[model samples]
Target chain A: MNLKIALLGGDGVGPEVLAQAVKCLQSVEVTFNHHFTFSPALVGATAIDQTGNPLPDETLEICKNSNAVLFGAIGDPKYDNDPIAKVRPEQGLLKLRKELGLFSNIRPVRVYPSLIDRSPLKKEIISGVDFTIYRELTGGIYFGEKKLNEKGTVASDLCEYSEKEISRMAHLAFKAAKNRRKKVTLIDKANVLETSRLWRKVVTRIGESYPEIELDFLFVDNAAMQMILNPAQFDVILTNNMFGDIISDEASVITGSIGLLASASVGTDFAMFEPIHGSYPQATGLDIANPIAAILSAAMLIEHHGLNEEAQAIYMAVENAIINNVVTSDLNPDSRFGTDYVGNYIANSIVDTD
Target chain B: MNLKIALLGGDGVGPEVLAQAVKCLQSVEVTFNHHFTFSPALVGATAIDQTGNPLPDETLEICKNSNAVLFGAIGDPKYDNDPIAKVRPEQGLLKLRKELGLFSNIRPVRVYPSLIDRSPLKKEIISGVDFTIYRELTGGIYFGEKKLNEKGTVASDLCEYSEKEISRMAHLAFKAAKNRRKKVTLIDKANVLETSRLWRKVVTRIGESYPEIELDFLFVDNAAMQMILNPAQFDVILTNNMFGDIISDEASVITGSIGLLASASVGTDFAMFEPIHGSYPQATGLDIANPIAAILSAAMLIEHHGLNEEAQAIYMAVENAIINNVVTSDLNPDSRFGTDYVGNYIANSIVDTD
Candidate 1:
C-alpha cells in the first residue's frame, strides 16, 4: 500500500524528535515492503517566524490532502511569557484541528512493567494499568464564546454543548470499549453544570444502544482522584474538551515514562498523531530528548491506517529498546544513547526481527 | 479564647468520624484552657431525610452565627446513582458556601513520611511534598448561570471571573506564601479563555506588590502533570474554582492518605473546615472510618481562630498517632482499631502530652 503523510515539526526539539520518527517509519517501510510518502510543512513557532501565520494556507492544504498527519510539539517561551501575545504556536494546532474536523482525541495510557520503578505510584497500583481516553477535541469551553467586559472588571467563557457533539464522541468511546474491556466511564461535572448534565443525558442515551458495554458516571473531581488511586479500574474514559485535557495529562504520569506515551486525534476522514509532550526549547539541540513518544506516534499513525501488523512491529521494536536499556537520559540519567541512537536502535531492531 | 463551633456531620461515615474529631477537640479545650462551645446541626442526606431540605434554614443560621464550621463528608449512593435528583445533599454545602461568602478553599497536600510507601509514586518523589492550593470558591463555572435550550438538546454554563474575586484569593495565596517558601504558582488556561487572561493580568499585577516572593504561571494541563512529576516544587497554587476542584483532588492522591488530608474554606468573615474525603455510605456506623481528617480539621478550625498553640497540640497528637501506627482499617487493612478506638487514642494522646 502507498500512503502520503504530512509531517509538521512545530518548534524546539520537535524537528529533532520527528526526524527519528521518520527514520523509524522508513525502516518499517523497508521491512513491510510498503511505500510511504512524506511531505513536510511549517507550523507553530517556526511557522510564526517564517510567515507570521501559525497555520498557513499551504500547510492546511497539505494536511487536508494527506492520508494522515504526524505532528511534533508546539509552543515557545517567547509566546508563553507574553500572555497578551495576539498569536501563538498553539493556534496553529487548534486551527488545524478545527479545519480538519478532528473531534476525538485518543490517548492510550499504558504502564510498561520494566519502567514501573520510575513511577511515583506503587507498582501494584499501576502494574496492569492500561486505558484509553476519548476526549472531544473541537467543542466545550475551549471553543466556546469568550468575552471581556468594557471595564475589564468581569470576564466570562461559555461552556456550550449540544447533543450532536456529545453523541459523536459517545459513539466513538462506546465502540472502542466494545473492543477492549467493554466499560465506559463518562467523566463530567453534571452536579453543577448544565453542560455536564447534557453530557450525561446524551451519553446515557447512546449507551443504551451498546447493551454489551458497561456504562458509569463520575464527577470530574472524583475522576481525577481515581486516575491516581485506582487507574486500572478504568477501561475507557469519555469526557468534554476541558476535562479531557486535564485528566489525560494527569493520567499520562501513570505511565512513568511520559516520553513513551502517544496520542491520536481523529475525525470522520482525517486523523493526526503526536506525542503528548510539548516542545522543550531548552533541549532543542542537546540530542538528549527522548524520541520514543514520536516513534510510538508513528506506530499509532499506521495503526489508524489499518496496518495492524506493521504498527505492532514498530511497537515491538520500541518495547525491545526500552527492555534493552537503549533510551535517552529521561529514562536513564546515565544512559549513553542520544536521541538519534535510540531511534536508530529501534529501527534496526524492527528490520532484524521476523 | 471562647469560640462557638457548628458541627455538621452530614451522612454515612460522617457521624462516625466526626465523633472522634469532637473527642480530640475536647482534649484540646482542656490542654490549652480554651472554651469551645459546640452546637450540632443537620445537613446533607440526613438533613434532607429529616427536614426535606439539604441545608435547612436552621442549619444555615447556626453556621452564620458560629465562629467556624467543622464538616464531615456528604453524599449517599442512592442520591449519586440518580443523575436527575433535584433535591440532593451537595446542594446544602454549596448553599452554605455561597450564603456565608466562603470564597477560598485551602487544600494543603502533605505527605506523611511513615505512609510514603502507601503512595503509588516512588518515595523519593513524595517524601517532602508539602503545598497548599488556594482555590477560589463560590465563583466560576460552578456558580455561573446554567441554561438548557428549549428542546434540551443544547446546554451552556458560564465561567465568569471578576477582578475582585481574583484579587481576593491572590492576596491570601501571597500572604500564605510569606509564611512558607515564598513562592506562588498560578494555574490557568490563559491562552484559550478570556477569563484566564483576566486571571493572569490580575494575578500578575498583584504579584508586583510582593517583590519578595517568586511568581510563576503554568497552564492547567501542564499543572496537572507537575502535580505528580514535581509536587514538591510548588509552595502555593492559586487557581480558579473549577481548576482548583480538579487539581486539588489530583494533588490529594500524592499524599497517599486521603483520609488524613484536611481542607479549609475561608471568606473575609466566615470560614469552614472539613475533611477532603466524602462520606463513605458503606462504612456508616461501622466504627472503622479514619477520623484523622476530621481531627485535623478541628486543628485547622483552631488555627483559623488564631489559637496557634492549641492547633499545634492537636497536630502533634495526630502526627504521633500516625507515626505510632494507631490508625483505622483504611491505613492498615489488618488493624484492629475501630473508629472510636482511634479517636479515643488521639484524644488521650493530646491529654497525655505537655
Candidate 2:
C-alpha cells in the first residue's frame, strides 16, 4: 500500500516531537514493507514569520492532496499574550480546520496501570478509567459571528448550531460507542441555551437509529464535577465546541501525564491527527519534550488508513516502552531519556517485535 | 439590630435542609440578643405546582421587601427531564438574580482538615486549597438573546458583555482579594472570542487601581486543566457566567464534600445566601441530606450584615460538629445522624459556645 501524509510541525517543540513520530513511522514502513511519502509544510507562528500568513496556500494545498495529515502542536508565547494581535498562530490552525471541514475531534483518555500512582487522583478513583471525547470542532462560538461596538464598551460572540452540524457528530459518537462500552453522554446546557436544546433534540433522534447504544445527558457544569469525582462513569462524551474544549482539557490531566494524549479531527473527506498538548514554547529545541503523544498520533493515522495490524504494532510498542520505564521526564522524572532517545527506543522496539 | 430575611425553601430537600439553617440563625438571634423577622415565600417547582408560576408576584414582592434572602435548593427531576416544558425551576433563580440585580455570585472553596481523606484527589494536591470564585450572575449567554429558526433546524445564543458588567464584577473580586490572598486570576477565552478580549481589557484596567494585588489571565480551557492539576495555585478566580458555573462546580468537589459548600449572591441593595448543592429529590423526606452547607450559608448571611462575630459563632459551632463527628450520612456514611439531628447539634453547640 502507498500512503501520502502531510506533516505540519508548526512551532516551538512541535518540530522536535514530530521528528520522532516520523522516525517511528519510517521504522514501521521498513518493518511492514509499505511505501509511504511524507510532504512537509509550514504553518502557525513559523509560517506567519515566513509567509505572513498562518496557513499559506501551499500548506493547505499539500494537506488537501494527502491521505491523512499528522499535525504537531501550534501557538507561541508571543502571540498568546497579545489580545489585539491581528494575525495569530491559532488562527492558522482554526483556518485549516475550517478549510478541511474537520467537524469532529476525537480524544481518548485512558489510565495505564503502571502510571496510575502518578495521577493526582487517588488510585481507587483513577484506576481503570478509560473514555473518549467527541468534540464538534468546526462550528459553535469559535466560528460564530463576533462583534465589537464602535465605543468598544460592549462585545459579543454568537454560539450557533444547525441540525446538520449536530447530527453528523452525533452519528460519529454513536458509532464509536458501539465499539466501546455502548454508552454516550451528551454534555450541554440544554435547560438555558436554545442551541443546547437543539443538541438534545437531534442527538435523541440519532440515538433511536443506534438501538444498542445507551444515550444519556449531563449539564456541562455537572459533567465538569463528574469528571473529577468519577471519570470512569463516562464511556464517550459528546459536547459542543466550547464545552468540549474545556471538558477534554480537564479530562486530559486526569491521566497524570498530559504528554501521552493524542487526538484526531475528522470531517467528511479529511482527517488530521495531533497531540493534545500545546507547543510548549519553553521546551523548544531542548529535545526534552515527550514524544509519545506524537508517536501515538502516527498510530492513529495508520489506523485511519485501515491498517489495523500496523496500528496495533505501534500501540504495543508504546505500551512496552511505558512498562519498561523507557519514558521521558514527564512520566518518570528520574529517567535520563530525551525525546530522540525515547523515539529511537520505541522505533527499535517496533522493529524487534516484528 | 433588627433584620428582615426572606426564606424560600422551594423543592425537594430544600425546605428540610433550609429549616436547619433557619434553626441555626434562630440560635444566633437568641444568643446575640437581636430581633429578626423571617418572611416565608414560595419559589421553584413547589411554587409552580401550587401557583403555576415558579417566581410568583408575591414571591418577588417579598424578596424586594426583605433586607436579605435565605434560599433553599430548587429543581425537580420531573421538570428537568422534560425539555419542552415552558416553566423550569431554574428560571425562578435566574429571574430572581435579574430582578434583584444580583450581579455577583460568590463561592468559596476550602479543604477541611478533618474531611481531607474524603477527597478524590491526593492529600498533597488539595491540602491547603483555599480560593473564592466571583461569577457574574446576571449576564452572558444565560441571559442573552436566544433564537430558534422557524423550522427549528438552527439555534443561537448570544454571549455579550459590557464594560460596565465586567468592571462591576472585577471590582468585587479585587476587593475580596485585598482581604485574602492578594492575587486575582481572570479566566476567559480571549484567544478566540471577542467578549473575552473585552474581559481581559477591562479587567486589566481595573487591576491598575489595585496596585497591591497581582492580576493574571488564563484561557478558559487551560484554566480547566490547571484547576485540577494545581488548585492551590489560585487565590481568587474571576470569570464570566458560563465558565463560572462550570469552574465553581468543579472546585466544589475538590474538598470532597459538596454538601459543605455555600454560596452568596449580592447586589447593591440586597443579598441572598444558599448552599451550592442542588435539591436532592431522592433524599427529600428521608432526612439523610447534609445541612452543613445551609448552616454555613447562614454564617455568610450574618457576615454580610456586618455581624462578623455572630458569623464566627456559627462557623465555630459547625466546625465543632464536624470535629466531633456529628455529621450527616453524606459526610460520614457510617454515621446514623439525620439532617435534623446534625442541625440540632450545631445549633446547640452555637448556644453552648455563647
Best candidate, lDDT-wise?
Answer: 2
The numbered model that scores best in TM-score is: 2
TM-score of 2: 0.93
Q: How far off is residue A23 in model 2, in Å? A: 2.9
Determine the iRMS, in angstroms, of model 2.
Answer: 0.5
DockQ measured for candidate 2: 0.90
lDDT of 2 at B263: 96
Q: Which run of 10 residues does model 1 chain B get worst, by summed lDDT?
A: B345-354
lDDT of 2: 0.93
**What is candidate 1's local distance difference test score?**
0.91
| Candidate 2 lDDT by residue in tens digits, A1-354 | 799999999999998889999988998899998888999999999999999999999999999999999999999989889878899998899899989999999998999899998898999999999999999998999989999999999999999999999999999999989878999999999989999999999999999999999999999999999999899999999999999999999999998978899999999999999998899999998879999999999998998788878888888889999999999988888999999999999988885343
Q: DockQ (Cα-based) per candidate?
A: 0.80, 0.90
Model 1 agreement with the true structure over B127-176: per-residue lDDT tens digits: 89989999998789998999998999999999999999999999999998
* Full-model lDDT for every candidate: 0.91, 0.93
